[model samples]
Structures are given as C-alpha cells and as structure tokens.
Target: MSLDSWAVPSNTGSMELTDTTPVHLIHVDPDVNMARFYGIELQPTLFGEVSVLRTWGRIGTNGQAMMVTYDDEAQAADALHELERQKRRRGYVPAGT
Candidate 1:
C-alpha cells in the first residue's frame, strides 16, 4: 500500500485517539517445538482513515505485515478484536502472559 497518497489535511477535526498500543501474542510449546507470534495494531492515517496492521511469523524473525484500511477507528478496532479472538482460539496468548 502506498501511504504517500494519504496526505494530511490542514484540520484533523475531532479525531480521538483510540487504543494505538500494539498487541503482541505468542504461542510456544517445547514438545512440538512450535513457536509463533502474531501482532495487531491500529494506526491513524493521514487521510482520516484507520489502518489495522497485522504481522505474523515465527518467533525471533522480522515476520510479515499486512495493512488493512478502514473507514473509521471503530471499524478498525472491531477488526482487531476479531483477529485477537481467532488467534486466542488457536492457542495464542498475550506475550507477557
């Protein structure tokens, strides 16, 4: 995706900051030597849109990222929650947990 096209406007209007904190989840089991990580974050765009950034790959690697633009923060937040739930079902848990 080209962020160059999302030029910032002079007035950003009433844009409230939502949960921009990145959520990092990991799953590891020594028996099967399975170790993986999944991260999700919500970012505000210059064009007044919200972006959901997702990254997943093996632990200790740079991994891959995919950005999905949403019309608003609420929609982006919902998408983030849904992804978290799916990951949790797959044995993924918060990094510190």
Candidate 2:
C-alpha cells in the first residue's frame, strides 16, 4: 500500500476548498532527536461536509494523518486553527520561518 491511499485526494477541482493554502509546520532539534512535521488544512467535500486534515510524523517521511469532518466550514476552520495553535505551543514552527 502507498501513502496516497491513506491521505485525502489532491485538489482535483471536484471538491471545493475554502482555503487552498495549508499550514505547514516543522520541528527539528538534532540534540533532542526530534525532527517532525505537522500540517493542517481545511477542505470541503462533495458530500456537503467540511474536513480538517491533519498530518504529522517524522520529517522526510509521509507520516501519519487524521481527518475530522464537520457539518460547516466554520467548525472545520476552527478545528484547524486550534490544532495549529496546539502544535505551535509544542515547539512546531512555520516551515519557512
């Protein structure tokens, strides 16, 4: 099996996304043996449901993911923000910064 099977499909235009931009975070500390990545994205599916997609695991690998679907975009967006905040508090930083 491949990682794609475990992840949501790429934005192929069939399902609309409120925010196409995903938040990417990373934590790297050689001394602590910590090198991981976490990402959060909000997407709307064709079934009229909003989903918050979260992926986290060691850097340089596909990692793991957990997705939660909500009835409205507001709820999904809120979940995404909350997850980002929690990860940030745990030492995850914006990938480019």
Candidate 3:
C-alpha cells in the first residue's frame, strides 16, 4: 500500500494526507479567491527545518506563495494546526468520500 491511496481528495484540489500521520494540507477556494495551507518537513540539506507554505490567489488565476520555516517539526505542526483551524472555521472540507 502507498501513502497516496490514503489521502482524501477534496474538490478544492488539496489532498488530505491520511497515510502520513500529522501531515495536513488544505486548499479552499471561496467565491473570489483561493487559499492554501501546507505543513511538511524540511530537506536534510536545510538542517531539518520544517515549514508551512501558504498561498492565496484570485480564483482561477495566479497567486503568491509564502514559506515560513521553523526550527523544529513541533513548531511547524503548531502553525499548520492554527491555519487549519482558521480554514475549518471558514468551512473548508476535505473533498473525497
């Protein structure tokens, strides 16, 4: 079994990472814009700095990307959790059944 199979694909185009524990991605496209949140580990060459990448753009158009690096995974996860909470409050849901 592969990790991909465990993901829940939301109509919003972001995959919910089920295979990987504590990993999450959320993308929500409201009427006028698109917002995304992601949390992941840093590459070894980067000295294991975790990061949260966020993005916002005009719906159906291009947007900007922002990456915030953390000294450790715990901090990154907290950031991810906070953003996820905000998205959920705004009614973002995982797509697939």
Candidate 4:
C-alpha cells in the first residue's frame, strides 16, 4: 500500500471554534527521535469531531520527511501537558520550548 496517500491533510477551513479568535499553532521540539510536533485544533471529516491533533515526524538525511498523527485535540493536549510536567520533574527542557 502507498503510505504517502495517507498523509495528513493541510489545515484550511477545517477547524470549528466556539470563539471567533484564531487558534494558535504551537510547534514543539522534543529534542528526541521525533524532530518536532505540530499542534493544531482541527475538525477533520474522518473523525467527525473538533479537537487538537499532535503530529510528529522526521526527515531523512536527504531532508525527506514523514509525519504520523498521534491523537485528536483533546487527547493530544492532555498528552503534551503531561509530557511537559514529566520533563519538568526530571529537570529536562520541556517540549515547545
């Protein structure tokens, strides 16, 4: 199967918000195997829900990258927050700087 066809869609008008204010896109670098995390609140049709999704990916030596979506917004936010707390306890620099 071609995995490239399963790539995440770009954020256009896919988000639904209670407020009219634009949501902030938080980019996080964990400094681990995964190069970075792109956090965005999205309303994806597949999931049929409005939530945040955390994506992590890495580019090869030649700069070719592949990303995998972790979870929906609610789950992603919770995971990210917990990760931050864990890093803090370990005295390590947290993700998202």
TM-scores of all models?
0.82, 0.79, 0.50, 0.30
Give the candidates in order of lDDT, highest first.
1, 2, 3, 4
Question: How does each model score on lDDT?
Answer: 0.90, 0.87, 0.54, 0.41
Ranked by TM-score, the better of candidates 1 and 2 is: 1
Q: Rank the candidates by TM-score, best first.
A: 1, 2, 3, 4
* Residue-wise C-alpha lDDT for candidate 1, range 1-97, written one tens digit per residue: 7776687555655355567888899999999999999999998888888999999999999999999999998899999999999999999999997
Judged by lDDT against the true structure, how good is candidate 2? 0.87
RMSD to true structure for each model, in Å: 7.3, 9.8, 12.3, 12.0
Model 3 misplacement above 4 A: 1-45, 95-97
Per-residue accuracy of model 2 over 1-97 as CA lDDT, tens digit each: 8888879766565467666689999999999899999999987777878888889999989999998999988788888888889999999999989
TM-score of 4: 0.30
- Candidate 2: Cα lDDT at 7: 92
Error of 2 at 36 (Å): 0.3
What residue runs in model 4 are displaced by over 4 Å at the alpha carbon?
1-12, 15-68, 93-97
Clashing pairs in 1: none
Q: Against the true structure, whose TM-score is highest?
A: 1
What residue runs in model 2 are displaced by over 4 Å at the alpha carbon? 1-15
Of 2 and 4, the candidate ranking higher by TM-score: 2
